[model samples]
Every structure is written in C-alpha cells, then in structure tokens.
Target: MKNGPLFFFGLFAALTLSWAGTVLLSHHQLGGLAPFYDENESAAFPLRQPGVAARGQLVYADLGCASCHTQQVRRPEFGADQAHGWGERQSVARDYIFQARPQLGALRVGPDLANLGGRKPAYDSDDLISLLYTGVIPGAKAVTHPYYKFLFDERPVVGEKSAVALKLTGALAASAGSQIVPTERAQSLVAFLLSLNNSYDYPEARPFVEKTEKKEGEKK
Candidate 1:
C-alpha cells in the first residue's frame, strides 16, 4: 500500500493483460479461419458471393443495417435460435470466410439473417424486392419495417410499363402514368439479402455435448 508507483504499475499491467487476452487472443484464434469443405456437396462451404451480391453487401454496410440486425446465431443451449427457426446450427467463423467485410452485427433488434435465404418457404428475389419497396410483410397488419421508397424511382411509362414496377394501392400507389421501379442499387441490395444463407453444417458449428460420469449412488 505504501508503494504508490508499484500499485499504479500493477493496475496498468492488469488492464493490458486483460485486453491482450480478450481482444488479441480472439483475433489470433479466428483471423485465419478457412471455409469448410463438404465432401457430399462437392463444394466448399460459404460459397463466394456474386458481383452484385458483393456490391449489395457494401450497400448494407453503408445503410447501417447491422445496427438493428445480427448475422450470427447462437448455440441451442445458449439460446433458442434453432428452436425458433432462425438457423439449424450455430454460426461459425467458417460461414464468413469468403466475405470481404463480415457483418457480424452487435445487436439483435431484428431476427438473425444468417439463414434467411435457406428458410422454409424461401423468400424469392421478387419477395425481397417488394418488401424493401413497401416495408410491409405480406399478411402483417402493422408496417413495422422502415420503407426504402428512396431506393425506387417513379417514372412515366414509356413504350411499356416496367416489368419490375411494384403494384401498389392506396396512398402508396404511384401517380397516374407513372410506375415505381427499383433502382440498380435496390436490386443489388436485394440480391445481397437473398444471398445470406449459412445452412451448411460445419463440424465446428455443431453443438458440443459434454459427457458426464455417473456417481456411484444407490440408484442404478
């Protein structure tokens, strides 16, 4: 207690050690992870994203979607991610090996999208495009999602109305002679969302079942 300099040195050492253990150690463990190769599928896990999906990933980052949604699913014992139909298995580093900038978001305001593309009753490209334009789930009463109307443009129909033009009603309907069509950016963003699939079962992603020994008790 009398040695003030020694006390300060000890405190600094403790802080430095903790940072190294938590931050540096974790990076070292997962930084060089590689994609898992599935023999039956004859392709490596975490398939590379196409050019449009890659660009869409950039858009996703710019729009700060990660602020509200997470891309990772927790282990079954840790949470009900699998039971709730979020994912079949816990997410592992191998799932993001091909991503330029993995969006392992910090929050979970929205559902985990790691397996969105592989969900039952899969959401097709058109479905995602419509959702982005309208912010309304097909049957839901309330429109809780933020509408990305700016992603689309209202242009007067030329020779033919756009095939991709959204069919709207009520206040959201386009003005007469105009149709709402998603821009290239919007299309790419949808592609990115639809590309979010991590359904492959990697060895590392499987749950760890701890073995226990039976104590020599009266009951057999």
Candidate 2:
C-alpha cells in the first residue's frame, strides 16, 4: 500500500514537470498567434489619465479585490454567462497584452468587470461611485458590496442640492460617518472601468477610430 501511494505521487510529479516544459516551450508560439488570429480590439473612450488608471490598477491589486472578482468573461459553453450580458464573448489573450500583470482573477464572488465601462445605466460613473461608497442603494435592500468611505475627502456639494445636503450633512458628512463618500475614487475607478470597452463589438468606439485614422493620414 505504501509503495502504491509513493509510485502514484512520483508519477504525478513527473507528469506535472513534463506538462510545464511543454507549455513554456509553446508560450512564444501562442503569443505570435495573437495578432494574427486574435481580432480583439482596444477600449473606446479615455478613462483614466494614463497615469491614474495605472495607479488605479495598483489599487485594484492592493485591495485584493481580484480574489473575489474575475475580470474575464467565460464563453457560452463554459457557463450561462451570455444570458447575464456579462460579456459578449470569451476573453482572449489580446485583451490583456498591455497589462503589466493582467488581472484574470481566480474566482467570481462579484460579477465580471470585462465590459463594465459602458454597461451601466446611462454609463454613469457617479452612480457607480455612489454605489461603491454607500453599498445601500437608497431604497433598495442592503447589498453585499463593500463600502469605500475611507478613501475620500468630505467636500461640500456644488450644485442645486444643497438643502438635502444640509439635512444629511448632520449625519452623513465625512466627519460624522466612517464612509469615504467614494465620489472621486469611484470616479477614478469608473474611469478605469469605463475604459474596459474593447471596440470589437461596440459601435461607440468606431467613430473615434475613424477620426483618429483620418487625422493621422492628414499628418502623414
């Protein structure tokens, strides 16, 4: 019985090493295949001011948020993901070529963020930010999302809603509450999210590409 167990373990180890060697050897070939067969496109609008989004990526990683959320969308065969509109297609390698370390998260506690940039209502970044800070969607039942009030400053409102602010300011002001309000940080994060639109299917991105190509041709 002891010999049987040892033999199986050894066999497993050998097979694992052989598989690793084969994959490593094939890695270059796989990369070369991307630009040829991979027609995946880049995001549409500018979200983060390049530096900020790069920093926000650090935020995503530092928070360990990736543990609970997967950035990639699985195709139809792997699951019923299509019905949810999480993404239109399975994530391909080209989608992440620019990431210094891509965030193909390991689990799915939260919905996939693959196409979240333009997916939300009216494509509103503020609403998403507010949701992140409150986690209580006003009249809706309490949600399981985390509150991120620790990351923002409490500033006075600028527009016509100051009256409601005075009422809530007594209780919900940054000083009185433990929440971060998430306005700017959420905006930054949403900027990052809104940037996730790969134009492979989105009509919104097409015009921008044409305009840019025209400009470049004129320059040439």
Candidate 3:
C-alpha cells in the first residue's frame, strides 16, 4: 500500500510497453509492405480487392461472419489446414496487407476462408448465392452455413426473368411468375466471400524445413 503510486506507474508502463510491442511494432513493420512481384506470372501477389469485393468485406464484417469462420491459416505442421484444403501454407503478414481489416478470427466454428477463392473445384458466384439463399451446399444433405434469406427478394418476373435470379427448383422454388434474386447486399457478400483467396506462396509463408544431408555415400 505504501508504494501504491509506484505500483500503478509500473502497471501502466507494462501495459504501454505491451501495446507498443504488439500493435505499434507490427504497424511499423508491415505498414510499408508492398505486394510481392512474380516474374513468371508477371503479376504481383495479393492482388488488391476490387471495389465490389471491398464493399463485400464490409458486409461480411457487418454480418459477423468472422465469428464462425477464420481468415488466417496456421502452419501445416501446426494444423491440418493444408490437408483439409483450408490453405496451402501459413498466412503471413504480407497475405493480409491489402485487407481493410483482417478477419483473423479467434475460433474455427466453421472452416477457415483464407484461401476460399483459390480452393479447388472453386465455388462460383452462383454456387455461393445458392448456398447463401438455401443454407445448404449443392449436394450436401445438411445445412453447412446460415441462410441469409433476407439478402434475397422474391418478386414477380416482369420480363425475361432477372439474369441474377436464383435458379431454384423443387420445394425451394419461388411461386410461378416469380423469381428469387439476390439483393445488393447479397451480391456484395457473395463477392466478398469469393474474394477470399490467399494462394500466393509468399516467402515468409513457407515453413522452414531444415534439410539433413545423408552421409556422403551411404550405400546409395
């Protein structure tokens, strides 16, 4: 109790140092990072998100998708992200330099989306829209994700049906003379989800596997 002032000052100092070490230091390190240029592809890594995709990221945050999904992939040895196709390598600071606010979710209630756009057998825009509207994947018997039905509008078709209208069949279909179409938010959200690609093999992302040279000529 006698050293109360000193104790409080020490606590404040510790907190200040922690903040500087984590946040400020990180900003100083990554703030000026530029995209990695690839000679073979003649393009830079981590392409900037398109205008629509950027807006979609806002929608994604608004919907709290990060609560269920993660945007960072751990090292393969640390996790099974590579085996499961979540990502091919661990995410590096460079991977997120272009994101407005990186959604490095804390929990993995659903799968990580750090590389969703680069996933094999990629999910097309229509596929994503259908999944969002139905809460079910194309062939899955169970619902995989929440159906943001509010993002869609069910209305009568005026002319030749909307080009963006949902091509639903079975009981999920809209009533005759009507078509289901994605609203602006739905389009934006889908665009954002489709933009989640981190396939670029940045130097920092690759794990360092030390090579062990076999003895000079151990019986070939």
User: Candidate 2: lDDT of 167?
Assistant: 27
Writing each residue's lDDT as its tens digit, candidate 1 over 58-122 gives 99999999998899989878888888788888888888878899898999887888888888778
Q: Per-residue lDDT for 111-219 in model 2, tens only?
A: 7877676453435555556556666554465767887766555654444432212223334445533333344445566566666754353232122333343442232
Question: If scored against the real structure, what TM-score would every candidate get?
Answer: 0.83, 0.62, 0.89
Relative to the true structure, candidate 3 has a C-alpha RMSD (angstroms) of 4.5
Q: Ranking under TM-score, best-scoring first? A: 3, 1, 2
Candidate 1 CA-lDDT value: 0.84
1-220, model 3: which lDDT tens digit per residue?
Answer: 4799999999999999999999999889888999999887899988999999899999989899899888888898997888989887888888887889888998898888888888997989999899999999767978878898999999999989999999988999999999999999999888888888887777667677565564643321
Q: What is candidate 3's CA lDDT for residue 177?
A: 97
Q: Candidate 3 — which pairs collide?
A: none
Q: Is candidate 1 or candidate 3 better by lDDT?
A: 3
Span of 10 residues, lowest total lDDT, candidate 3: 211-220
lDDT, residue 178, model 3: 97
TM-score winner between 1 and 2, please give it: 1
